[model samples]
Target: MKGIKIGEYLVNSCTMYIEPVEYANKIYSHIVEVEEEFLSPFKPLQNIKNSCDYFGVDYESRRKGT
Candidate 1:
């Protein structure tokens, strides 16, 4: 779980968002990158579509106003 610090949070290379919720209140939303290692573990059994299945969010459909 190694990542680079972006502003007050850390963003990995896998395009996942991780940050403190309290500080995030200042902004509408927080978007952070994820690391390959984090994603590599799930690569075998998981299929990553738009947004994260873990969050139950349809990132693509949401962006299209669906």
Candidate 2:
């Protein structure tokens, strides 16, 4: 976690964002190792998903105009 810093962390919640001061790959590896303890206890092993709708994918339809 040397080059990694926790950003926009919510207390008592599993949701947290981390920023890397150095290479991104290294940061990802570190997270994978401790994901169980770092993430939700109910489902410790979960696939990471993008929170944004980049490239207009709209996977969750969050930007739908209705």
On a 0 to 100 scale, what is the lDDT of residue 28 in model 2? 30
Candidate that would win on lDDT: 1
Off by over 4 Å in 1: 1-51, 62-66
Q: Can you write out model 2's per-residue Cα lDDT over 1-66, one digit (the tens) per residue? A: 342332222222353443222243333312323333232221111122233322334444644532
**Tens digits of per-residue lDDT for model 1, 14-66:** 54543222232332123444323222222221233412454576657645774
Off by over 4 Å in 2: 2-13, 24-49, 54-66
Residue pairs in clash, model 1: 12-33, 12-34, 13-34, 13-35, 14-34, 14-35, 15-34, 16-34
Native-to-model Cα distance after best TM-score fit, residue 56 in candidate 1, in Å? 1.0
Quantify all predictions' global Cα lDDT against the true fold: 0.34, 0.30
CA shift at 44, candidate 2, in angstroms? 21
